[model samples]
Structure formats: structure tokens, C-alpha cells
Target: MTVIEIDGLSKNYGADKAVDGVCLRVEQGEIFGIAGPNGAGKTTVVECASGLRRRDGGNLRVLGLDPQNDRRRLLQRIGVQLQEASLPGAIKVGEALRMYASFYDKPADWRELMDEWGLTDKRRAGFASLSGGWKQRLFIALALVGNPEVVFLDELTTGLDPSARRTTWGLIRNMRERGVTIVMVTHFMDEAAALCDRIAIIDRGRVAAEGSPRELIAKGRADSLEDAFLVLTGGETA
Candidate 1:
């Protein structure tokens, strides 16, 4: 099943083309990575696909629904973790989770999610008091609280330490096992290499390349995903 489809998608800021004529398909129950240097339109593509931004051209569908025209219905079936997210400074972790849970028709137990993400001990902690990694974990919990079929994780492990990053990666794999389709936007080559079943490298508002990490490396004649990324995006990998 194709969970997401985009063809000739375009978005612009003034005269600048942020995303231009990009096409891609994401299958069900797969981890799809969108990677590129900053301002390469990677985020713009997802923002458009998720209905956070309106596209200027082309067609897009999420679960066979037009994200722009069917936003309310589509939102119920998908969750998005933006590149940057925050809660009110005074909101406690548990409070935040509960609030997010209320948005969906059917929600997972926030308490269970807190325990699963190791946020149980920090339930009473204010959002402001939590460290970067803990905050990320909480955001992830919020994203999944709705029990969405498709989840967008953008820069999910950006500020986490190595240990926390690994733990989060494990959680992502577990999510895939449970049949959730994921569209991840990340700059971490190692993260993409380890987690993504397929990757699309966007550059200058276009898709520079798309393939598995190994295939990309082989095609680029590089030693690793990192080197392949560098080669594909013309030395820009963010």
C-alpha cells in the first residue's frame, strides 16, 4: 500500500523555489528518510505533504486522501513531530501528554507511553526542567499518543546524547515492527543508514538521489552513506 504519494510538487517563498517538481512514493510500514543540507527543501516537502504548508503545484496524497483538501480527516490518521516543537514552560510532562491524547479519536495511554519512553520519573517535571533528550522523548510520545498509522519524525534525535539516540532508534524500529509507516527528516547520516529502508536526498529544491543506503553508496562509488551523501549533494550533507 502506498501511504504517501507526491508528483510534481512545488512550493515557493517569494521568487525562491523551496520545493520544485519533486515526486516520491512511500509505502506502508516502511521507514522513509528525507535528507539534505539546510534549505534544500527537505522540510518544505514534508510540510507540504503534511498540510502544514500549501503547495503551489502538483498532487499529493496521504493514505489516498488529499492532505490539503482533507486535512481534518487526514490529521486523524497521521501524526507529525516538527523539526522544532515546544510546550508551555509551566506544563508538566504528564499534563502535556494528556492534552495531546485528547486530540485523537482513539488514544494510547499516556501513562504507558511515558513508561515506555522512560518519562515516568519525569511525569511531574515541568517542560522547562527537562533536558533536551527528555523533551524529545516527550514530543515523540505526543506524536504516537494518537496511535496514528503514519508518523512524521523530523530531526527526532537532534539534541540527544549518543546513548539516548540509540535508545530512540530502538523505539523507532519497534514502531515499524508494529506496522506504522514513518517519514523521517534527519541530517544524521548514521541514523538514516541504520533506520531508513529507503532514502531520498533532496538538494536545491530537487531530488538529487533516492535509494537504499547501500545502493546509494554503491551508486555514488563511496565508502559509506555519509560519503555517498556528500557526493550526491555536491559536498552538502547538513
Candidate 2:
């Protein structure tokens, strides 16, 4: 089943086209990746699908309903972890989890999630005192608190150490096993290659390519996903 459908979607900021004629579909339980260089309109396309940004053209549907028109209902069924999320300077980890749980009609057990994310030791720590990896883990826990059907993660592992990145990858795979669909946006080609069932590569406000990591690399006659992406986008040293 298709959980998301975007057809000829376009978004513009004044004279600049952020997303242009982009089309893609995500299956019900797949880990879908959107990859591109900076300013490739990846974020804009995600925002449009998540109903955070309205498109200037084309159509978008999440679970068979218009994301813009059915935003309230859609939001209840989906979770989002934006690139730049912030919390109160003094908010404790436990308190932050509780606050997020209160927003959903049926939230997962905060303690369980804390343990799953290895956050029990820092439950009483202030949000400001947490390290980058801890903060990312907290965000992941918060995104899953609602037991959402679809989750959107933008640049999920940007500033993490290798160990933390691998740990987060395991958590993401576990989420898929529990039947949650994921839409991830990242600049890291290896992350997409390792996690995504299918990937859409965007360039200059358009989809430059779409396929499994292996398929894309095969098409480019390249040995790696990053090389394929560079070839397609005409990047230097690609």
C-alpha cells in the first residue's frame, strides 16, 4: 500500500523554486530516503508532504488524505523530527518526555522509551546539559512517543559519533519492524545506502534519480552510492 503519494509537486519562494515537479511514492512499511547536496530542495519537499509547507502546484496525499486539508488528522497519525528542534533551557529530560506525551491521545510509555534509547541515566539531566548524541536520542524518543504510523526525520544523525550513529540506525530498523514507515532526509549517502529501501536523489529543485541504492549505483556504473550521487548531480570529485 502507498502511504505517501506526491505528484508534480512544486514550491516556490518568490522567484526561486525550492521544489519543482517532484514526484514519488512511499510504501506502507518502507524506509524511504531523500538525499541531496545542500540547497537541493530536499527539506522543502519534506515540509510540503508533512503539511509544514504548502505547495504551489501538483498533488500530495498522506494515507489517502490531502495533507494540507487534513492536517489535524494527519498530524495525529504522523511524527516529525525537524533538523532544528529546541526545548526550554531548563527542561529536564523526563519532564520533556512527559510534556510531549501529553499532546497525544495515546502515547507510548516514557520509561520504556527512555530505556530503549539508553536515556535512563540522564532522565533528570537538563536539556541544555545533554550532549549532541543524547539530544538526538531524546528527539528520537519524543518522535516515537505517539506510536505514529509514519515518521519524518530530517538530518537525524548529523553531528553524532560513529557509535551513536550506528546505535540510532538500529533503533530506526526496530521502528520499521514495528510497522512504522519512515521518511528520512540526509546529506550522508552512506546512511541512506545502509538504511533506505528506496532512495530519491534531488538536485536543483528536482528529483535527479530514484531507485534502490544498488540499482542507482549499477545504473551509473559506480562502486558506491555516493559516487553515483556525485555523478548524477555533477558534483566535484564525485
Candidate 3:
């Protein structure tokens, strides 16, 4: 049950390749991760898969539909939380959620989502007034509002506090339990090792290495995922 498939996928920025002849597959209901250092093609590849960017070459399919050609259907069935998302500063938390919910034919309950994301007290707060963690939580809640079968999360915990990060991780696990597939892009090795079923380590516009956390670590002959990633990518650990 492959939910996503990429064959020799490539994306170019002017003359430079951002994603170069990459191939990967994500199974249905699995938590797949794309990990890499800065300047790597992780973002490019995920953006291509999400149909936000058109690929320069190769084939890509999401749930058996061509991502670029069948974008309308794909967009309806998949949720995306981009690395940098912007909302109107004057929009209240609840207003924002309701606006996003309107885009979907069937959406989750806004009230329940507010409480679950610990956003109840901040429901009336303006987007500008919310803390970094609260904003991140709201983004997560919005992404899930559509009850999408597959979700793309990029740097989801980037600005969250330690407790908030853990809380978001728990919510991600809950999404998995509900049979939702997740495609996550992150620089955090610990998050990848802990949550990902399979990880693709991309570097210099290509997949440098890929496997389960244990398999990757074993292949690198490293003690931990961080050490393995550093050894493989030749980059410093965060």
C-alpha cells in the first residue's frame, strides 16, 4: 500500500538542481521522514510531492494519482503545514481555524480541536498575540481539521518549547493511530529516530542515505542517530 511514489524526480532552480533524480516511496499509514542538513533538497522534494512545486523531471504519484496532474484531487485528500506559514495579524485564533475549515467538505470539530490543541483560552486571541508554541499548535490543528488521509509537516516543532514539542509529538502519534499517513521534513535526528518508520537522508540535491533509524545507524556504524546523520551527511549535529 504505497501512498506516495517518486521515481527519478528532479527539481531545478535556474541552472542549479534542488532535487536531483531522487526516488522514494512512503507506505500508507506510515510515518515517513525526510532528514537533511541546510542546502539539502529535503524541502524541494517534499514540495514537489505536495504539488506546491512542479518537478523538472521524473514521475511522482500520491495515492496513485499524479501529484502535478491530479493536484485538485490530491490537495483535497492531503493536508500541508509548510515550514513558514503566514496568517493575517488581525485574525483571531478561532477565526483562522474556521476559515481553514471552510476549505474542506468535511472537517473536524473546531471546538474539540481548540481544546485538544490547548487553544481554548486563546481562542479569542489575535494571531499576533499568540506565543510561538501556540501558533505552531494552531497550525497543527488547522492541518488536521480536514481529516486528511496524508499530511505533510515541515519543521513542525521549529519554534515550540520543550513541553509543546512533546505535546505535538503526541498529537502526531494520535494521527497515526487514526490511520493517517505522515510525511515529515525535519533536521532533528531525535524526532526522526523516535517517530519515523523510515527516513531518507538527503544532501546536495539527492538522497544520500535512507532506512529505518536502526538500519541507518547500523550501516553508519554509529552509536546514535545523531552520530549516524553527522557521519553520513558530513554536517554538525544540532
Best by lDDT: 1
The clash number for model 1 is 0
Ranking by lDDT: 1, 2, 3
RMSD of each: 1.5, 1.1, 1.4
Quality of model 3 by C-alpha lDDT: 0.90
- In model 2, what is the error at residue 107, expressed in angstroms? 1.2
Instruction: Write one digit per residue (lDDT tens) for candidate 2, span 39-140.
Output: 999989888898888889999999887889998888888888888888987999999988898888888898899889899999999999998878988998
Identify the runs in model 1 with alpha carbons over 4 angstroms from their true place.
Answer: 236-238
**Mind giving the per-residue lDDT tens digits that candidate 1 earns over 44-154?**
898998888899999999999998999999889898888878889999999999999999999989899989999999999999999888899999999999999999998
Cα deviation of 56 in candidate 2 (Å)?
1.7
Residue 116: error of model 3 in Å? Answer: 1.0
lDDT of each: 0.93, 0.91, 0.90
> Which pairs of residues have clashing backbones in candidate 1?
none
Winning model by TM-score: 1
Q: Could you tell me every candidate's TM-score relative to the true structure?
A: 0.97, 0.96, 0.96
Off by over 4 Å in 2: none
